[model samples]
Structure formats: structure tokens, C-alpha cells
Target: MRSLTVVGPSRVEWREAPSPELQEDTDVLVRPIASATCDLDRRLVLGDSPFKPPYALGHEAVGEVVATGDAPCGLRPGDRVVIPWHISCGTCAECGRSMPGACRSVHRLASYGNTAGGHWGGLFDELVRVPWGARNLVALPPDVDPVVAAFCSDSLVDAYRTVSPPLAAQPGATVLVVGGTASLGLLTVLSAVALAATEVFYVDRNPRSVQTAARLGATAMLITSYSEPVSGVFDLTVDASADTEGLRRALKSTRPGGTCVSRSVYFTEPALPYLDLYASGVTLVTGPPHATPHMPEVLRLLSSGALDPRPVLAGPYSYDEAPEVLRDPPPGKPAFAHPRAGAA
Candidate 1:
């Protein structure tokens, strides 16, 4: 099997690897049908994150079941499932609270492509393994497009986590999203509008992403912050920009007693203004997205035609092109189409 391997900073290529197998009765071997690059993946490419080289490189993928061991959940060959980015025991206490991203059974940062966890390879592999298959794999709806499946494995679910709870608490609230990480902020706009946020404002320097957010129902703005010292009121503010200044501006724009969610992960200790947050009574939520519990709801919205992320998809490139694309991915969120959909 050939897998995308990161040899060093800004270096990636396809490498041969032994084919994976169903290691346990509850495990399954899947062939990726579609896969994509997430914000975290890009950070690693630039050597901005802590990961070392010579490892399989991907986290988000939608795949077809090639073989399944008989244990309990009756998943069969040909069934499609979205591979969650984290490896977790679905029955753990943290998972019960919808925090599978912090499962106690595995390493705290147990992800497919990272070094902290055991090397389980990456989603870009020709064949991937799913542990505790019944709990980890979210079966795809029959009619959902394969391309949409790839991107939603993490991006859409993370976006759902960013806005769903806040929007639920304050019905018909206004939203402001600061995008820089990747598709996350744009997807947040899509999720917010679908969930009944009255007005949505998106800020980003990338014109392509700004336009994409507009098509998804947000009023896109190119400015990161107000030039004059006027605070624009917003019911909720989400900063997917991993920059420190961007986060500062996002906090300044929030209304008192409103909610602010920062979906970006920081590699360094950023100096944050705790005094302002305490004084304003802002409800702040920031962490790695625990997307396990919300995948079902996001999939439901896609199945009903309420959300279509295909507009943001950049490719269905062949597997032969995976090396170059992973090395130098095109603008916007891109997806690679694999012929493994018919691996059965």
C-alpha cells in the first residue's frame, strides 16, 4: 500500500507501506474514498507544529469498508463510514460527556498522524484501520456525496461544535467569524446561518474564502478589525484565525454578556486579556473540537440538503496526484478522490 509521508518540513511524498489488517474482532479495514487537508495538516506542512517527519500524513477521510470482523455492530463490507480524527474508546467517561477528543483510554493527543500517539498511520493510506469500529465510525447516509464525506469528517463537525450550543442558547443571535485557520471559519458561517443566526458577518483577508462565506449566507468583510475604535456589537464571535492579533480583535468586537468561541489551536502561550473578559462577562469556549457526538447531526443536515459544502471543494484529484497536492495544496479546501470506493 502507498501512503502519503511527510519526510521533513515542507516535504511530502508517497511511500510504500505494509497493508493494514483487522487487528481485533471489533476492528475494520477501510479504503479511503475521499480525503482532504485540514488546518492542522497545513500547519504541520509548514513545520509550525511539534510533529517530526517520516510519518503518514492525514486525519480527515471518508472511506468504504473493505473488510469487517464480526464482533457486535453489524457493519459490513461496502458500508461507508467517516473516520473520526481521534482514536477513542466510545464507552469511556469523557466520551460519554461528548469529549471523545480527550478519551482517557488512549494518549491525550492520540491522533492518527501524530507522534504522541502510537503510529496508526494516517487517513491518506491506501487502507486504514478503525479500532472499536462500531463506536468510532459514523455510517454515512446512502445518498451523501463521497466528496462531501471527506471534508465533513472533521471540518464540518468542528464547525458544528463551534456554533451549535451558543446558537441554541440564544436563538436568532448575530454572529461574527474571523477566518484564517482554513475551512473552519467558513463552515462556521454555513452552520450558523442554517441554525437560525439572524445575521452573520465573516472577516478574512482571503478573497476566495470571503466569497465562499458569502455564498454560504454570510456578509463577508475583508477587514480584520475596525480602524476607528468603535466596537461592533455581536451576539457571538468565533475566531478561527490562529493569530494573536486576530484573537484580540475578535474579543474586542464581542458584545457584553455574549459568547465567544475560538476554534484555532495555538502552539505558543499567547498573552490574553483576562481583565476585559472578567469585566464584560463574556462566555468564552476554546479547545480542540470534540466532534464525535456532533457528526450525526451534521450529517443529517447534509442529507436534508440544508448544507452543501461542495462549493468549497477544490478537487477530486486522482491518488497519483496525492503526493504533489499534499506537498503544495491548492487554494481553498481541496479534496482527493480515490477509486477505492469500489474496493469491495
Candidate 2:
């Protein structure tokens, strides 16, 4: 089998790798039918990330079950499923509490597609192993396109976490999304609009993203600076911007008692405006996306046509093009179409 390996900054190549097999009674083997690059994956390929090279290069994918263990799971051979980026035993205490991303049974930060996690092969591989199959795989609806499954694994789910819960808490709330992080901010805007927010405001230096946000029904603004807040306060503000200044702007733009959620990862410790937070009573939420618990709902939205994320998909490139496309990826998310889909 061949897997995409990140050999260095702005470099990737297909390397011969071991084909995965079902190692446990509960384990399953899958062939990626479609895989997409997350914002972090883009950084990794561009050599802009903190993680070093020599690791498998993908995490988000929708795959076909090529083989299943003897254990009775909801899935079987030929089933198309969404593979979560994180690895966890579905029956763990943390998972039982709806925090599968932090499952105590696996190594801390255990996941596919990154060196920080254990050596689970990347989704870009020709074959991959999925442990705890019953708990980790979500069956995709027959009506949904396989390409959409690419984002369902992580990017879309991460954006869902940023907006869905907050909107549920504050119905028809106004939203402000700062989108320097990449596709997340645009997806966040889309999610907010789908959930019926009174108004959605998007700020990004990239005119392309701003234009996309407008198409998604957001009042998009192209800003020259991340240092200053967007025009008005909102019921919910998201710091999808990976920059510190953008995070600060999102925090300061949150209305009194409003909530601000940041979906971007910060490598360096950033200072916050304590006095402003104290006076405004702002609630700030930040952490890795707990996507497992929300995967079902995300699927439900797609199935019911309540959410349409297709606008953000950049390409449906063939598997052979994964290397070059990932190296110089276009603006939106890029998904690769694997050769085998329903192989026995």
C-alpha cells in the first residue's frame, strides 16, 4: 500500500507502507473513498505548522469498510462511513461523558494524521485501520455525496461545534466570525446562518473568503487589520482567526455577557485583556473540537438538507493527485477521490 508522507516543509510524496489489518476483534479495515485536508493539514503541507515531518499526512476521510471483525458492529463490508479524526474506545468513561476527543483509554491526543498522536496511519493511505469500529464510525446517509464526507470527519464538525451549541443557547443571536484560520470561519458563518441567526458578520483579510461568506448570507467585511474589532458587538463572536490579534478582537467584540468561541489552536501563550473581560463578563470557550459527540447531528443536518457545506469544497481530485494538490492547495478545502470505493 502507499501512504502520503510529509518528508519536509512544503513537500510530500507517496511512500510504500504496510497495509493495515484488523488487529482486534473490534477493529475494522477501510479503504479511503474520499479524504480532505483540514486547515492544520494545509499548514503541515506548507511547512507553516509546528509539527515536524516524516509522519502520515492526512486525517479527514470518508471510507468504505473493506473488512470487518467478527464482532457485531453496525457496519459491515461495503458500508460507507465517516471516520472521526480522533481515536477512542466508544465505551470509555470520557466518551460516556461525551468527550471522546479526550478518551482516557488512548494516548493523550491520540488521533490519525499527525505525529503528536500515536502512529495511526493517515487517511491518505490506500488502507487504514480503525480501532473501536462500533464507537468511532458514523454511517453516511445514502443520499449524501461521498465528497461531503471528507469534511464531515473534522473540518465541518469543528465548525459545527463553534456555532451550533451557542446558537441553541441564544436563539436568533447575532454572530461575528473572524476567519483568518482558513475554511473554518466560512463554515462557521454557514452554520450560524443555517441555525437561523438574526445576522452573521464575517471578517477576513482574504477577499475570496469574504466573498464566499457573502454568498453564504453573511454580512462579510474585508478588514485591513486584525488588531481592531469589527464594527459592532454580537451575541456570539468566534475567533477562527489563527492570529493573536484576531483572537483579541473577537474577545473585545463580544457583547456584555455574550459568549466567544475560538476554534483555532494557539501554539504560544497569548495575553488577554483582563480588565475588559472583567468589565464585560464575557465567556470565552477554547479547546480541541470534541467532534465525536457532534458527528451524528452533523450527519443529520446534511441528511435533512438543513445544512449544505458543498459551497466550501474546493476540488474532487483523484487520489494520485493528493501529493501535488496538498502541496499547493487552493483557497477552500480540497478532497481526494480514492480509486476503490466498494471493494470486497
| Residue pairs whose backbone atoms clash in candidate 2 | none
Write down the TM-score of every candidate: 0.94, 0.96
- Residue ranges of candidate 2 with Cα displaced over 4 Å: 339-344
lDDT of each: 0.82, 0.87
Determine which window of 10 residues in candidate 1 has minimal summed lDDT: 222-231
Shift of residue 10 alpha carbon in model 2, Å: 0.3
